[model samples]
Target: MSGTLHLAQALSNRRRRGRKKDFRDAERLVKRLVSQELTLSFVPDGEHRLWRTLTRTRYQRTRDKVRLQNQLEALLEEAHINLSSLVSDLLGASARRRCMR
Candidate 1:
C-alpha cells in the first residue's frame, strides 16, 4: 500500500511537470506571435473572391447600415465628452491675474 501511494505521487508529480512545460511552450509561442504581429490576407482565388463579394453585399444593405448606425449611436451615448470650457476659463483667469500683477 505504501509503495503504491509513492508510485501514484511520482506519477502526479511527473504529470504536473509535463503540464508546466507545455504551458511554458505555449506562452513562448504566443509571445513570438505577438512580437511579430499578425495580419489577415485574402488571396484572390475564385472561391475567396465569391465569398468576399457576398460578405460585402451583405454588409452594404440598408438594414445592416441601420443596425451599425444604431450600435454606434448607443456606444456614443455611453461615452463621456470632456469639455475644454472650464479648463480654458481657469487658464484664462490665471493668465489675466498674472498679467495684472
Candidate 2:
C-alpha cells in the first residue's frame, strides 16, 4: 500500500544507483511527497476522476451520433433523397417526418 509514483524524467535525472536502487528511489520519493517537497504530479481525487469519465463518455457518444447522422445522410444521398440539403439536421423531427413519406 506504500509506494512512490515518479516521472520518467525525474527518475532519469537522479545520478545515484545501488543494488537496492529501485527501493531507495521509492523511499526518497515517498518522503519528498509526505513533506510537500515533491510537486510534479497532480493525482486527481475521486470526484475529478468521475467528472472526467462522464465528460469523456458524453464527448464520445456525441461524436458517434454525429458520425451516424453523416452516414445516414450519405445513404439518403445515394438514393437521390438529398436530406442534408432540405433540412439543417438529418435527424430532426421534421426530417424524420419527411423521411417517413
Candidate 3:
C-alpha cells in the first residue's frame, strides 16, 4: 500500500512537470501570435485609422476578451499557474501599490 502511494505521487509529479512545460510552450506561441498580429495591424496604410479602430474594438468586445481569457486559462492550466492569482499578485505588488497608497 505504501509503495503504491509513493508510485502514484511520483506519477503525479511527472505529469505536473509535463504540464508546466506545455504551458510555457503555449504561452510563447500566444505571445508570438500577438506580436505578429500587432505588427501587421500597425503598418501605415491609408487604412491605418480603420485598422487601428478595428483592433481596438476587437480587443474591447466582450466576446473577444473572453476568447483571449480562455486561451490564457488553457495555457495557465498547463503551467499550473492560476492566472487570476498571478495577476492579483502582480497588481498588488507593482505600480498599483503607489496608486493604492
Task: Please name the candidate that would achieve the greatest TM-score relative to the true structure.
Answer: 2
RMSD of 3: 25.9
- Candidate 2 segments exceeding 4 Å error: 1-20, 30-37
lDDT of 3 by residue, 1-101 (tens): 35211111222222323445777755654565556431222235558878888988887896776777678667766888554654643334653554365
Superposed by TM-score, candidate 1 places the C-alpha of residue 37 at a distance from the truth, in angstroms, of 20
Ranking by lDDT: 2, 3, 1
lDDT (tens digit, per residue) of candidate 2 on 1-101: 99655543465336365565777778876677667675465677789999999999999999999999989988988999887888898889989898889
Candidate 2 whole-model C-alpha lDDT, 0 to 1: 0.78
Best by lDDT: 2
Q: Stretches of candidate 1 above 4 Å error? A: 1-42, 62-101
Report how far off residue 35 is in candidate 2 (Å): 6.8
Locate the minimum summed-lDDT window of 10 residues in model 3: 3-12
C-alpha lDDT of all candidate models, in order: 0.50, 0.78, 0.53
Structural similarity to truth (TM-score) of each candidate: 0.22, 0.71, 0.25
Error of 1 at 67 (Å): 8.1
What TM-score number comes out for model 1?
A: 0.22
Count steric clashes of candidate 3: 0
Q: Sort the predicted structures by TM-score, highest score first.
A: 2, 3, 1
76 Cα displacement, candidate 2 (Å): 1.2
